[model samples]
Target: MEKKKELENLLVSVSENDDYAFRVFYDLYYRSVFRFAYYFLRNREACGEVVSNVFVAVWKSRVALRRIENIDAYLYVVARNEANRYLKESRTRRRCLSFEEIPISLIDRNSPPPQRRRSR
Candidate 1:
């Protein structure tokens, strides 16, 4: 089967609550999603969490999956958003807790430092 048609069928099946179809979709995209998220979150644990969260989002929003034209692009966008969310929540926690309380790995050094806007 052509890749496009296969993905379309998978999406339709998943929207109809087919667990096996969802599993096939997950298996097909899990690695790419993981690597895409890892590019933002270097830590394995955090990346794993992001991957889980992304899939959860997918499943929760499965009814709408068939309407999505480009699954790969949609997945990447979700992964990026989740990774950013994780980073934001981690920063908030670090602010509330002592520096020594949080593990050093949560600090995302690969993410560029926030830029300050210049006010006139």
Candidate 2:
């Protein structure tokens, strides 16, 4: 069977409350979604987390999910958004924790001057 037909059938199964269909869909798409997510996260664990989260969101939204022309495109869009969100948060965290923003007075000022050090 063609891959496109298989994916569409699985998506229809999801809409119809079929567990096996969902499992099959997961097996088929997990790797692609993970790879797509890895582009943004750069870490395997974080990429896996984002992929799983995207699947969960898709499952939850299945009831209201409208007619999508391409299942792969839909999944890719979801994975992309999740990865971008994670990347943004990670960047924000790095920005917030940067040492350059710390007050200069907080630096250790008790060290002796380099010129005053005696020869070893």
Q: What is the TM-score of each candidate against the true structure?
A: 0.79, 0.70
Tens digits of lDDT, candidate 2, 1-120: 597676666678887878887788788889889988887788998898899899998899886444777777888899999998888888898778458776555565775434655889
lDDT of 1 by residue, 1-120 (tens): 597898899999999999999999999999999999999999999999999999999999999999999899999999999999999999997779677775555676776666779999
Model 1, residue 97: what's the lDDT?
69
Model 2: CA > 4 A from native: 1-3, 64-66, 95-120
lDDT for 22 (candidate 2): 78
Clashes (N, CA, C under 3 Å) per candidate: 0, 0
User: Top lDDT: which candidate number?
Assistant: 1
Stretches off by above 4 angstroms in model 1 are 98-120
